[model samples]
Target: MRPLTEEETRIFFEKLVKYIGENIKILIDRPDGPYCFRLNKERVFYVSEEIMKKAGNVARENLVSLGTCMGKFTKSKKFRLHVTALDYLAPYAQGKMWLKPSAEQQFLYGHNVMKSGLGRISESVDRYQGVILYSMNDLPLGFGTAAKSTSDCRHSDPGTIVCFHQSDIGEYIRSEDTLT
Candidate 1:
């Protein structure tokens, strides 16, 4: 693994900022210790400074992965976040949407959330904004982009799509062998 170059950092942060906003500072400057992003085989990993030091000693070929796999950089140079990033993104998400119990199963099955399934939404969310999807009980289920703004949602039909599905925790089981 190696440190992300300036260009890579900019691209990665641009995508991350959409979901977490300015909280990116909190991620890098945590009270406990400093953490950073590293790249290995196009996949980005979030690792603590101390762990990064240790990892540096291992041979590159043998170090398959280290720390939390945030996501991967596609061949086209775009970043695609993985479900593993939910833990980090949930706490700092700027826009959030809660799913009704009845709709939870639908979302987990990789379907886009419909207006009828939405239990609640952050009033600040705008159309096409990145949003973290949660269960009624506040469990972070996944992340997606809003298909409609808060006001549009209130007036739209129940069948209208509210959030577009991206990545979800279910992916861990559905694609177990490919993760990491």
Candidate 2:
């Protein structure tokens, strides 16, 4: 697949926001890492297939509290998750993050701590702020990163407010020049 044009990425995000709702919480993985989430209603939802598929809308609305924004579910038009306004859980501690396009980028690795027993061992969607599509011939120097022992660390794309742990390279189509 070829790299997505800026318009294409924007359209994709618009569709996601429409389908998932603005206030909905989203957890997702990066191209090659763990997971992260966005419980804050004001934050832009980061959609990665790896994390979204794992959780698959296990949580919803008020009770939904927290769950991974698996890309498998959100990236696809077929995913129909329960859409309801989110009431941020004080205990979980939520906030909104932002993102934009740039030449350089970074990724982090970590897991969600919103569930019982699991303690959010599995990565979720809070990580990603957004995507930065570059010309097919200009890929970011280190768009990808690795986890330190996989103990759940917060990864942030300094350029963009978006952050994620796991890497979801499959989500984006790469071309020879795009990342070069």
Candidate 3:
């Protein structure tokens, strides 16, 4: 377990604040102790469970990994906010793409969504920007990138609306269900 270097800390904060917000700065002040850093790939850092605990009640048991992995990002490797972190994030993040239960089933299976499948969407999501995917009842399902801008998703009849579902709670449940 290695501590984050001063430079790494700065990079982490800059990247995280971009995805999340300035609010996350408070939690990473020291970037040591319970919080540990490991880089699985250059420019891709993984933060430990103890670090996540400081963010409030992150639901780690439902997650496959305790580490919150974030990348500097490219089209294929977009920024990811783990399901464990969603507990502390849903209230603060701006865009949530809410989906119906039926749509959620396919989505959990890694299917991209069409505009018709969205129950509701946030006000100003831009194309290619990441979004929080929410259940119809407002629970955070996971994270995704907007396949189309909010306007296009709202008005277009046949465009795909959310491309990569970065993570989802139902997918975890389904994976567990399969093991039995």
Choose the strongest candidate by TM-score: 1
TM-score of 1: 0.97
Kindly list the per-residue Cα lDDT of model 2 for residues 92-169, writing each as its tens digit.
212222212221132211221111111111233323322211113332211111211122333322232232222223
TM-scores of all candidate predictions against the true structure = 0.97, 0.18, 0.63
Q: If the candidates were sorted by their lDDT against the true structure, best first, what order would they fall in?
A: 1, 3, 2
For model 1, how does the per-residue alpha-carbon lDDT over 101-172 read when each residue is reduced to its tens digit?
A: 999989988999999999999997999989999999999999999999999999999999999999888999
TM-score of 3: 0.63
lDDT of 1: 0.93
Q: Which model scores highest in lDDT?
A: 1
User: What ordering of candidates by TM-score runs from best to worst?
Assistant: 1, 3, 2
Stretches of candidate 2 off by over 4 Å are: 22-180
Clashes of each: 0, 46, 0
Error of 3 at 147 (Å): 1.1
Considering lDDT, which of the candidate structures 1 and 2 is the better prediction for this target?
Answer: 1
Compared with the true structure, all predictions reach lDDT values of 0.93, 0.27, 0.60
The residue-by-residue lDDT of candidate 3 on 22-59, one tens digit each, is 65644455456544554333333356556545533534
